[model samples]
Target: MKIRKIAFLITFLFLWRGVMAQENSSSLAFSAYTDVYYSYFSNEMEPNALQPFTTVSPRSERFGLNVAQIGLAYDSQFVRANLILHWGDIAKATWSEEYNNVQEANLGFKLANGWWIDAGFFATHIGTESFLPKNDFLSSTAVATYNEPFYQAGAKLTYEGSDDFYTEFWVLNGYNRFLDNNNAKSIGVLFSYNFSENTSLTYTNLLGTESAEGSAVKQYRIYQNLYLNTVLTERLILIVGGDVGTQSNSKLPNMEETAIMYNALTTLRYLFTDKWSVTGRAEVFNDRHGFISGLIPTQNSGMQGLELWGLTLGIEYKPDPNSYIRGEARFLDLDDNAALFSGSYSRHKRWELMVTMGYQLDRVFGF
Candidate 1:
């Protein structure tokens, strides 16, 4: 009788556990990611030693960790949430100074007709390139992408109906900020359309005040971003992107007319095999007034704003669906007397080499 009673108790507990597991089965997942790389620069003493508008692998001529992130996501019939935290060179260089470690912490709810409302910090929908190497064709970002926003704190309304188009409207603290730099707010929108499974275009714009609270200058900025992704052949991919922006004249000590800047780039990736691919990019940036790139200081006074272009070629080897090893060589040149960098080490041209390895843990629950 004692043995029978023990067996019955065990069976009852197993049934109860199965019922609880079924009842709590929701789309919850844990994700982790990391990338490490080695990069070298031609002029180690130049001011571009800050890596010249870069985040990943900012350490030159040495091995470094680009970024390491871990997060949790949950989605259900009515609600969803995401929380991601990161550390490494990417976070230190570009993330918000106050909330530097928080990559994303957002919550959302489903609304009528494929619409959703979300609030909190988010990766900006503005740029053509990504900081994550695996997400982009190249290991390093273009100079144009470096000037674009990387992160934002905001509330957004997103619409993704049955049509091929998707749109998002945002109200935010300010451009590229997690903390409100001033009392004023910013707004923006993004529109994306998919012509086919292999082709799409995205357009984005931002209107906001970038000046700090106590600063002497008060500037209102209007920025536009656009990009397209398409496959010219089964083995070849192409991307073209551009950015144009203008700011209201803030009458300062050196007042002037409205300031304007533009950037453009095109990238191509050719796949030689299922596991091998080569990617190349050409890019240019023009900021005539030094509004964005700043005036290149000559021996005495400030010269023209930056006018620069660059070329990059990279090869990638994918060992699996979630891991990649990449090698790239890049060349950057400044035109005319607009030499870049500072101090006694100004340079008109330089070369860079980088090799990176990346992996993602798509789902590793309770680990």
Candidate 2:
């Protein structure tokens, strides 16, 4: 009861503030989205033992709330501020222990000559996939789950060289860390180019040193991402993405050896009508040194490498611009000796089906 009261109070305060800001001509905006789904796995794996990237529907045959998020933004000619709060499974995985439910909090200043600077927590500039379901063709891909940083706390400077080209540079605390875990900071840059209204490309890179809790060793990590989006025809679209990363000098026994991982994926979407669409995706991921695939080491078995290939087919129906229902079926093929999919036993293949419903409310309360 107490928790419910607190939640209600928070919601009320956010709405009240948004309304007052609008009335005062402060240029405030509010938006929210909710995603929920049900998923079933062919292997009947217990909920607690499901693999990573499956957190959205952790239970094998149950309904779940993936995420409920609210965002507030205030913008003026010279200054801007934004905040996002989230709840449910995505919040548990993406939010740090310190921040709890706060997904993003940032402030920005518009400088002269099309240059701008911003500081505080912000979404990562890398990856073709987004944390929000509405932005994705399917639920998610392994590359997005294992090889990307969800968020970063940092400052950045951006330049709009022209209408078609943009670039940004970042100085961050570290990957996904709200509080700096070590003395070393990460540096990254993003470059984007729009070829036309129908095509675009992006490239991103990050390099940093990370220290685990209670450990003195500093692990060096380097990561790169490339993404391309193109419209092939009036009804067809294509997306291509690739990622590569490496980590070295860990606390493991072989500090000299570097672990490497990479993935590539492509997706195609066809819109048959204004309210209906179909999508297909193919992907390959290689975790050679078990660094990003969450391999568990056993006394006798040691660490095992993982290679995965996946394909997905999905359909989406939009009742309106603000609501959608999607259904997807995914098939995963693993290496012969990989045991990550079927408990302690090795499995070469696994499959899952999922259905999701999502809604977005933008300024529904006149905010």
Per-model TM-score on C-alpha atoms: 0.87, 0.85
Cα lDDT of model 1 by residue, 125-203, tens digit: 7888886776898879987777788899989999978578999999999888888889999999999999999999999
Backbone Cα, N, C clashes tallied per candidate? 0, 0
TM-score of 2: 0.85
Which residue pairs collide, candidate 1?
A: none
Clashes of 2: 0
What do the candidate models score in CA lDDT, each in turn? 0.84, 0.79
Give the poorly placed runs of model 1, Cα more than 4 Å off: 1-25, 46-49, 214-217, 250-256, 299-304, 342-346, 364-367
| Root-mean-square deviation of Cα positions for candidate 1 versus the true structure, in angstroms | 5.6
Per-prediction CA RMSD (Å): 5.6, 10.7
Model 2 CA lDDT for position 36: 93
Look at candidate 2 and tell me the lDDT of residue 285: 87
Lowest summed lDDT over 10 consecutive residues: which window, candidate 1?
248-257
In model 2, where do residues sit more than 4 Å from their true spots? 1-26, 43-51, 213-216, 250-254, 297-300, 343-348, 364-367
